[model samples]
Target: MPERDTIMRELHDLGLAAWFGGSMMGAVGLNPAAEEQGTEVDKARVASSGWAKWTPVNAAAIAAHLVGAAGLAVANRRRIAGQKGVLASTLAKTALTGAALGATAYARTLGKKIELASSPEQEKAKKAEKHPISVESAQGQLRIVKWAIPALTGGIEVLNSLQGEQQRPSRQIWGSLRRLASA
Candidate 1:
């Protein structure tokens, strides 16, 4: 048996958990609540504020997840290379991660656009000042980008489950055997 990458596993699981949960909550709860704000401008402001607050923690979680995933990949390089289905799943996970990252970055970018576009005249950020977008345009972009993160991260969790099952000793043995038989 191999030594467990315990820390890496925890970081990977926890970070992903936070990432998924946060996106779900924002989509299901925060965004909906923000939509209830009296005016359209208020709605966008509330939503952008909620997203802004989450941005730092989300970034940290994403970073932690990536670091943990890299450590785990290195630790499990042999299994990933030799075990049947593992490589395929890992590749799939990687693709999902990439998509999630892109979606996250895009959403944050939209958030910044919203913040800039919606900020009170007196409280504008310099960067946002330089690139002016209409509040309606920012809101429109946000609406479209909203679902991608949760969906991508949710797929990652599903793949995580599959990968978890693949780690069973019997399954490992069978997978490796299948690989060997096919070689």
Candidate 2:
């Protein structure tokens, strides 16, 4: 752990930054803006289009973050195991990261559900989905789920900050000492 993992840290930070920013923007900016459209179909189309546009970039961000997180874990394995506070933060981060991923994927599924449900052609819709859900229902679910993404990711960011703090020389010294004492 003597050597710094600058690249990994950069990737983790930049990726999480984009993920958090994009989710917030979508929740506050894009979704509400899409709501101003004249019709439900239009709203769905607008929101879905915006999310679709961002999907690839978001995927890249998540991938980068996961890779960086793995790299960082490997780099700081000793600290994570030996430091008093680091293990708890690392476990919490891991759980939050998994939850965030699930929330993101679920949001996307709900988005697509509403988007397709908005189609006027009944036969086509039925063909696409055997039991197509109501647009209202799908949207209702989406409204709640979308907010979870930012919340979960934000929690992960806070955990990241705590991890950073734990790496400080003073914190490291105390954390290690505390770990040894507990043993």
Candidate 3:
């Protein structure tokens, strides 16, 4: 096939950058700031508000990343099918992305629970959906899941680098031969 030019690479890299940076900033900056600025009773509310504001942007970033990934996959179908290790790495990246998405969704759910539990507005608190677990327990889980998001996304970045390296002329030639022999 002829060489195909696309902006998928830029989209993928920039989307991942936003996702990673936003998560890290929320964990390190926004959350701490909320805790410090708000009263004891309002800390969770403050943090939850900030995260709520970020949710839409984060969703967009994740969507862009997924679209770019699909585009790249379609463009490189032959390479993925014929290159040794490429298929494995692609599969691993897919799984990691799914995990990251799940972590993000779970953390958001936990955050919402904390927000309701901490709010002074009894009506709002009452309106919040009940979780099977206590708000305190969800908070504890959120603390860990929040950090896991950035870590998993960072791992995806590393895997992306490996994929780029594998595209090198020498690596591609060797990978193709290895793939052929194994087949």
Candidate 4:
């Protein structure tokens, strides 16, 4: 109801939006495109090249989301005392983010392996398949990362809502202070 509350709510909303948008783009847009492109050997090269080019953009997006989340956490710190539900949600989100980070790193490592071996001959492919370090593993890792993004993003949203609820009282306090000063 108070201005500070409104601002905190808006900050929480912004964090949720960034988390959702980044995760959806990574899952639905980037991962799918990479999969489709990686089907053919030449296409896989092109796809990897394209992804390499986009790495900075992806990193920027991720960094922005992390920064936003941290800001939201700071804003909500004081209000979390009476909001156990919100605190729980924030903790869950933090845990999910950490898991997603690990999964994402695993997926990237697998992708690099696939890229490095992109030019193997049929016999080499077969040999590699026998002790493969590419497609299947990469796909599995990507799948885990893909699902993780959404799960983590959704958790962030819940955390944001909880944050908003917790900050409501502080917002009122600030508003009351302003009103008293004005009078």
TM-scores vs. true structure, each candidate: 0.91, 0.92, 0.92, 0.61
| RMSD over all Cα atoms, model 3 | 2.0
RMSD to native, candidate 1: 2.0
Higher-lDDT candidate among 1 and 4?
1
Judged by whole-model lDDT over C-alpha atoms, candidate 4 comes out at: 0.60
Please provide, for model 2 over 1-183, each residue's C-alpha lDDT reduced to its tens digit, 9 standing for 90 to 100: 334588888889999999999999999999999999998788988998899899999999999899889989999999999999888899999999999999999888778776666667786466437545666777888889889999999999999988888999999999999999999
Writing each residue's lDDT as its tens digit, candidate 1 over 3-117 gives: 4588888889899999999998998899999989998778878988888899899989988899889988998898999899999999999999999999989788778877766
Model 1 residue 11 lDDT score? 85
Q: Candidate 3's residue-wise lDDT over 1-183, tens digit each?
A: 233325777677788899999999999999888879646567788898899899999998998888889888998889999999999999999999999999989898888888887778887677565667677788789779989999999999999999999899899999999988988
Winner on lDDT (1 vs 2)? 2
Candidate 4 residue-wise lDDT, 29-109, digit = tens: 765675666356765565555555655665665565676567656766654433435556667778876865665566556
Each prediction's whole-model lDDT (CA): 0.86, 0.88, 0.87, 0.60
Quote the positional error of residue 81 for candidate 1 in Å: 0.5
Candidate 3 off by > 4 Å: 1-5
Stretches off by above 4 angstroms in model 1 are 1-4, 123-129, 132-134
- List all candidate RMSDs to the true structure: 2.0, 2.1, 2.0, 7.7
Q: In every candidate, how many clashes are there?
A: 0, 0, 0, 0
Using TM-score as the yardstick, the better of models 2 and 4 is 2
